[model samples]
Target: MNASTALLAAAEGGIIGDGRTGANLALGAGALGMAIGWLALARAGGGISTGNVRTGGMAAIAVGTVCTVLAVLHLATASGGPGTGNGLVGAIVAVPLGLGAVLLGRRALTRCRRADRPADRMTV
Candidate 1:
């Protein structure tokens, strides 16, 4: 009703209202997406015989990237105070998770390489 009251409500509600719920959802979804991507990447690099790991790995990374981008976008664009809509939170969370995925993938590749090596058995 009153201008001051309306302004206060808006301030508490965020830019698009609902206290930036949309942003929160987007950011959360992004994190989950990144996780899925990491799994795919690792599986691809692992010594698995099925699912075409190479292609799956690439696709997973791509999907994860998209999710991260969306999270950053929402966190930055949404209007809120301090931690409410800050992109740093999402980014910080994503970095470590992403790194872990990379490590797993690298390990898988190493295993695959070692497996390809000739065995130490004698040629009886």
Candidate 2:
């Protein structure tokens, strides 16, 4: 698959694998889902303005990062609480989603930059 396709797939996989509705898991899952939706739309062929897609993807990345960090912090604190097991679950899910978001964001940025380059100068 192409880079865009691969990125979108990874993002979607992360989103689907994320389990929502449990302490930090909820936030992390939501963030991952948003990222997947945005990036997937961005990669789709001729469905929307590239600028809008880029903006949405960037926003998702930012939100996902914040959510991941917050989830991690929650997990760390819950180590002393009864919800430690839930926290562990969140951590397990969040790490992969967070890493995927970062990678997808980088890929989207790279694609945007490449798209902006003068077509005539593009090498085959």
| CA RMSD per model (angstroms) | 10.5, 11.8
Off by over 4 Å in 1: 1-38, 41-47, 83-124
lDDT of each: 0.48, 0.54
lDDT of 1 at 32: 58
Q: Give model 2's clash tally.
A: 0
Best-fitting candidate, measured by lDDT?
Answer: 2
**Best candidate (score: TM-score):** 2
lDDT of 1 by residue, 1-124 (tens): 7964543433333445565543344445455545555555555455344565444444445544544444454444446455755444554455445444444445444544555668884243
Taking all chains together, each candidate's TM-score versus the true structure is: 0.44, 0.58
lDDT of 2 by residue, 7-84 (tens): 333332333343223335535554664666456456743455545556655765776675565455545534344453
After TM-score superposition, the amount by which residue 69's alpha carbon in candidate 1 deviates from its true location, in angstroms, is: 1.5
* Global fold similarity of model 2 (TM-score): 0.58
TM-score of 1: 0.44
